[model samples]
Target: MDASVRLHLLKSCISYATHDHVRKSGHRASMPPKALLLTSQPSLRNVVSRAWRAATSITPYQTSCFKPNKNWTLRSIDHGARPYSAKTKPTVSAVLKNIKDHTAENIVSIFHSRSNNPYHNLAIENYLLRNSHAQSKILLFYTNRPCVVIGRNQNPWLECNIAKIQEGLPWNAADWDDGVLDNDRHVIAEERDGYNVSLDLVRRRSGGGTVIHDVGNLNFSFIVPNDKDFTRDKHAELIVRALMAPMTVTRFRDHVLYDNVHVNQRHDIVMTCANVDGGNTQKEFKVSGSAFKLTRGRALHHGTILHSSPNINRQVFVAGDEGGQVAASVFSALLSSPAKPFLEAKGVGSVRSPVHNLFDVTDQVQRREVVRSLRKEIGQLFMDVNGMGDISVEEVGDEDCAVDMNGEIYRDAQELMTDDWRFCQTPTFEYRSEDAGGALKMRFQVKHGLIQNASLEHVELDAEQQLKFAGLEGKKLHEIQSWTSCLPPHAGFRHAKACAHLETVFPKIQPAGAAREGGAESTIIQEADLSGSNQDGIAVKRKAPGGRIELERGGENVVVER
Candidate 1:
């Protein structure tokens, strides 16, 4: 045999003999696969021979415990199991008390949310998610209770008006320095342009440190517009259609990329109306042998609802019981309409908005339905902005105005709250070499007069200009650095491609790590599994250049596999 081959054979004989002795002495079942590798590879012959000599030379320690399988596999469960229990409901008083404690710090009033408890929160979130088939109530305004509002397809920071949010952005514009009508004061109305008006101010109600804010009573309404071409029934139809269609929730990104989306699911909502029909039923109740009565409407259950809203022109959103309460409260207070609960619990008192006729309603039927539906419990599914910075519907308690007065205000006052209002999109300012002194280009996203996002674009400056700009001081010119980020204070994020310039300014952000190190020698194995495909006693695989081992198990051969 060749000298190298002879050395490997000698090492293998020693390992086999030692392992046999261990098995006979009840210390182990078999030799480790690593021992076999050391015996087989010519490059490891010397090391293996030395190890064998040490094993033969060493005296045994009487108290030492032998671990039979040093390379044992660790297994774990994918999903944890939870015990099941009968579904329970939260008491109205407890829910109210929670909201009251949460929103207590705010000045002006109006609150809305799905629920507070994780169970109710999850249940309500799921319920609305499941029922987003209808284009129902989007402005889930509450008159006297409190709730949290998460953004739609927006990072809460990007969608929310931060300054106003921090300063207790009132749902009503009255509290805002902005000249627009307040959410709590003026009834949301539409303008001739058809776009819902929005205040320059950012209003937010954070979930943290949240407490209850008393919304006098609850009022709910599906603000469906009745234009000349759209009737109340048509508006209701649009809401139903929108609700029936599958609703979607998604993530916001500066650049669109798949997998950037974290959550995508249908809205959970349930519809029950004495007048609607057609849908599969999970359980049915009968009045008289053949006559059937509708009790509950669900997606997986029976109902005459479609999976998506039919209206392409209308926007749709649904409210849970808590949401419904808040909406009913708002509608009741603004419309002078009494608040009706989801099932019962009538709201006490006359309803009126601080501004009159806020809907900016031009159509008589919609105006009437908007007024009429204020009292009925038929369960509404309709479309309208409810004056989310749009047009005014009506005033609740305007001292000089009639109950139906339509006060126009935005064209005159929207900017009153501007400078302090934190904007969702911080305008990016770019300076060319000429605009800025030399070849250096500057880009930044500003918030509250602070540069939260910054970058410089480098270019070769003429010798004369470079000397002039360079005199201004400490700046690197040749280096081009860039990075992607999701900063605090705002949730909207920009993830730029990695660039050389950014590599210098931000070194640790680089993707290369031990994971990128070359060869298995540089790779660290914390654990491994040996089962099924790894039925073999041992398996060897080549590690990719980056130290990622792609193991292909050859079954039915070895006692254990690693």
Candidate 2:
């Protein structure tokens, strides 16, 4: 049988078993309780009510939210007489407290965000990582303001709109200093002070396409033992079910169903980010997405959820998107949904899917409620995972996580999120030059800190000029135009135009004196060096600058051999 069909059958079987268990119980009450009626399915509520009315005419049935017993089993009238107390409540910290060991492989804990600022939360994760053992598993959920987060290996100049930020602020022209950038997160704070602006730009150690963080959005990270967790369909399915839970669906009005949102099960791979689909194209609507980072033998899987709201709309549609088509379709889905506060879309292709925030689509739900529902679902999933059946779990309210606003963690996080580390550290990339002619568009590509390719749209290169241009391929971007000694006159203007575009993309860039043969030591390893014998190098030649250098320059031919 198909996996989807099997999962459906499993759900049906569980529902049937729950209904049977509820019906056979000998517990009796003066009125039919709310929890009992819901177990039979929403459509059968009328039949259940009529049967109750016929059997017991003394008192009317009173319904309330369902709560599982201490043993994690469904409750009947007898046990439903009283609700569970605060002791059984579950929060990320509280669930963790119940565990006897933190480093146990199966142990899972949910941690609430300490602050709305993205820096503090990540900093806390860093602090915890410093003290954690390899076997520990942790999950963090946060909601941040409008900001851009880059992948560990990405070129920030190409990934972010740095040119528009304060009219293309200039960064340090020389190569980034490792003594200053020394694996420290504090540089972000220094840049904030230097730039006289809040450090909103950030680069996470994980890999993924650029994403915009906004209000009405939830971010989740699962730090597990290995990459094996990414392949498990069960965990992904649970996350999806919680993301589009009944409560969230109800808030959006009946026009959209749980089917409106979907997930792609691929690790470290990103799908095209379009506006949330409203039942229109066959293109899968990726409402929730994730990226992974395997570090120190542990894996961190993180992603985002687009909850409904104006703040989300403003923050999610950053300048890089295809303008407002995506945002339009999303809001249209919400506004056009049916009166029932649920989603059900039959038509695909040209028939757009309904996508709306809960507030715009329905009158009954709130942001807090939707978050609560997700937390509850996740808590229950934990119980099932640990084989702790029928356990009591409540969505606890917020509390201070003991992180001082002016403390070390906060300061470190604040500094590590600055523009220098976020923008200047990006791998070299080309950009459009504003000073160039109206129709003169130029493009360039750089790799390993060297300009690999350069092009002038309508301009072609002659013999000597073409060879010079090709020779300039492996040179540093800033140094490409400065090689005036060897290049023929034709390559000068072309080189200058290319550099102009490069600086426009990377504002702070300046023409460094010469191209150093020994590359600077990288703070973050982009890719693991696996080219040696049996994936183990006899000697990793990739090392930081510590040796004396010898310069061999005979006329125009100059090389800084280290």
Candidate 3:
């Protein structure tokens, strides 16, 4: 008669029906709707409707039970719910269980991460490497947002343009627009700002050259047992086969040549094509770069596939003999350009090669289609190579997925995001810079991203100035908020010029908010000085708000202004 009493009765009836159904069918019904009888009372009907909906909507794989609080309201108990958060997503344990179940000996498991966070994706890959069954083979595919990923043993400063990476790449709206007829460019413009989209710097637990990742690229990692038969080029060759597969598009069919694509001596996937000038000359372009990580019993071989990177040259073919100069992506060339001459780094350096996007060769192949083709092709190849059958494939990450922040995967991601891992992990290096006027020369010996030694020459310093110069030692290069702050206040014209040179050569790292706010005022210096001598033997010039300064070799003197 009363609401509470009726609620109890309704719950009992549902429970009894559920148990009876399990007894008869050997499986629990998701919700025994048939056991629910129509109730005329308004108060009881609302409770019954809520309980029934909640129970029925639960997935078959999920087990839920109805529980009543003191308020007489019903709540469905979720066994998979994580203690850290109440969101309805798969728990870390559940996901790990799923992975463990599929990863048996002789099994090939394919996991595609939906998260664009490089740290998260890489952490998931690492988990599979360490946690999955040792004998099982794993293929993980993921794409990250714009980020420059350096190898574990590589120097970030030597491998990438840290300033550019910190400032972020420009957002090109047209490049990202899906060609849906109903899409509005204005709405897209409103949604995104066409300014500096800052890229995250990630240091992966792998040993190889640095690489740039953007939405236009796809990353694949293969985790196989560390057996004697394993080779670095094995998976790389599989990628080549996938790339050489016949394209459905007739227009680009001729472009996909088998001999044109193969793994080189460097274990990199490269594509060779005829010069667009109709000459007999051929051009080679690197489409993918490989990196490997080895554990005691497992080996991880991962690489990138440049499909339709917007940062690259839009023109499919260049006009003249200079056609070979086109890079795979602007970011790849600019960001990964050697920071030599200025920085004598100790870690691994990227081998400079002309890179080309696969889209250019295939006439803008769809990224999704490329991923699908690669997955299918690689799955079959893996099975055939391992002499296995019936591989398991599934997508692993999602927006709603519950991530255990305290777990090993989260810790791994956090470690990758730390400043120590990003900067301090860099090998020993020396940075030498001289003012355009030749009045000031500075050399810094950096180890573990800290200035172990600082030398300032060609400039006279007073007691305070000398102290400031000495202070530069033991300071972290990345932690310096402003380069000018490191110089003595009103020390001299020479100091001012040296400050400008240092600022121009090595832009101080700024927070994302500060970078966005002050980016407009930031000076853009040509990278020619950092890379070394200019081929044309021309003067390198830098423009500031006050005046322009030109750097030239020979007897030419630098022109400076107040």
Candidate 4:
């Protein structure tokens, strides 16, 4: 028989078989039977099999009779011929089980996040804290892109220069026109260019002073049982030991470089050096800051290590010897708001201190070597404390794993990224602003991130202007994209200047529409659905800007326009 005629007969046979099976079982058939008839008649089976192969060779079969069923199972046909099975998503219980398995058998479990997303890394830390084995100790290492992370109870306005952070650090030619000079009056090789990376503002769950994280910095977290042995300074001391330990690198083999580094009263790691003239005078600069969180039965301690962050204010530097030039100050101080003197916040305030990078202490040390040294020293300490054998490090946060373990991690990350968590959680504060001559003064009382009261001090206004000013009472501090929008039309120059000052103090919050339309950071979270598969089968495609196609789903408003 001709090939086309054979394929037509095969199709007819498949349709009939599917209709018969559905009529008998009242459900869709997984696969039409080529076995039952083929076993009885071998010649007919061979002909049908040849026809099926010929049809599939041209293009995939897309017949109306072959509908997919969720409950379908793959089974072998005649002569041990098995059909392909589609990939299935991992269940929530299965993901949880995998985590439990990793922690249950191992006394010391180490994880290194491959994700640069701060929210995702933090969420993974939280997940490990809540779900890991109670008796097992967990260590996680992660690095975030350029971002300013404030404590849970801290105020963003007082801790950071919101305008600078939102706008990012742009290169200034004038500042770098002249080469950077060290204490010796010699030019240094430090890059004159400024960092142009996008900065994200985050409010973490742990309570501590605000800190900045970038690619050059490494964050280490410890999740251990909250027992009598657990102290806030334990992990910090371990970190200090790691810094003071001799490097594995050949050039620095016999040298213990960070001997001056020690943990301070506040659990922060600092480096203290004596004056070059052999005097008693000592200079100290913080190299790491620690933060802690205690749950019912578990305790979490996480801290940042400044390796070689280039985001530093070149104006500030520690004096070194005649041949030594040290760049130890971070640009965080420069990015902090100058309005701290005027704003009286209710939450915990950061203790201002001079910071230095580990690289400055020894130019021979690299970020990878720092991480390796820290990991080795910390792992040794953990093993000594727990009397455990050697342990291996596990990596997480890959695309497939992130999709599989998206239940709690996704929710926690989404919550942390929201404006409600970032800004609305701020404590009540009072902002006072005035001109240089004190002729114009404005005071705002903000509670729970909303403006509760507004009064223009030492200024007169009409009834309409007063009403317009009153309109600011219920407005949210973060939602206000522009301070001018809240002011009355043709407001006086003084009022405009005061509003402009307020605008500079407050960070710009991205609108909900912008988030839905795919804004920064949020876009990374929204593009991946909860189930990792489209719940709705309907898809709409449209041509977007830059000649890219945007894919939108019907049931879920997922806009994937990468």
At residue 464, candidate 2 shows an lDDT of 36
- What lDDT score belongs to each candidate, Candidate 1 first? 0.23, 0.40, 0.59, 0.57
lDDT at residue 234 of model 2 (Cα atoms): 43
Give me the overall lDDT of model 3.
Answer: 0.59
lDDT of 1 by residue, 419-521 (tens): 2222222222221222322313434333332332344334244543442332312322211122222211111211132222222222221110112111113
Candidate 4 structure quality by residue, lDDT tens digits, 91-202: 2224333776768887577776655567777888888888888887988887775678999899888888765555454323122111111000111111213333235788
Off by over 4 Å in 3: 1-93, 97-101, 173-193, 247-259, 275-280, 314-329, 336-339, 361-365, 398-406, 434-436, 458-468, 489-493, 510-562
Model 4: colliding residue pairs = 328-356
Order the candidate numbers by lDDT, best to worst: 3, 4, 2, 1
lDDT of 3 at 59: 35
Error of 3 at 179 (Å): 16
Best by lDDT: 3
Q: Candidate 2 on 1-562: residue-level lDDT in tens?
A: 1234223323433344344336645743212222222222433444444554443331332222221222212222322222222434333443333333443533555555524555655665554443345666566666653345556666544444542322212122111111111111122111111232122456665666555454455677666667455443445565766545665456545434234444444421112323334445444444555666666777676776655334323221223234343333222221221111111112111222222332332211244445555655665665567555443432211121222222445445655555444534555545433345343344445544555455544458653354345456455543443333433344335755444434443444321111122123223211232122112112222222322111111211111111
* Candidate closer to the true structure by TM-score (higher is better), 2 or 3: 3
Once fitted onto the true fold, the runs of candidate 4 whose alpha carbons sit more than 4 angstroms away are: 1-97, 170-195, 247-257, 274-282, 313-330, 360-365, 398-404, 434-439, 458-468, 489-493, 511-562
TM-scores of all models?
A: 0.20, 0.46, 0.66, 0.65
RMSD after CA superposition, every candidate = 29.2, 24.4, 19.2, 17.1
Residue 275 lDDT, candidate 1, scale 0-100: 19
Model 1 quality (TM-score): 0.20
Off by over 4 Å in 1: 1-202, 206-363, 378-419, 424-449, 459-562
Report the Cα lDDT for candidate 4. Answer: 0.57
Instruction: Please provide, for model 3 over 212-326, each residue's C-alpha lDDT reduced to its tens digit, 9 standing for 90 to 100.
Output: 7776678999998989968999999988877765642243454333236889999999887776436566878888999999997999999998765666663321112243544
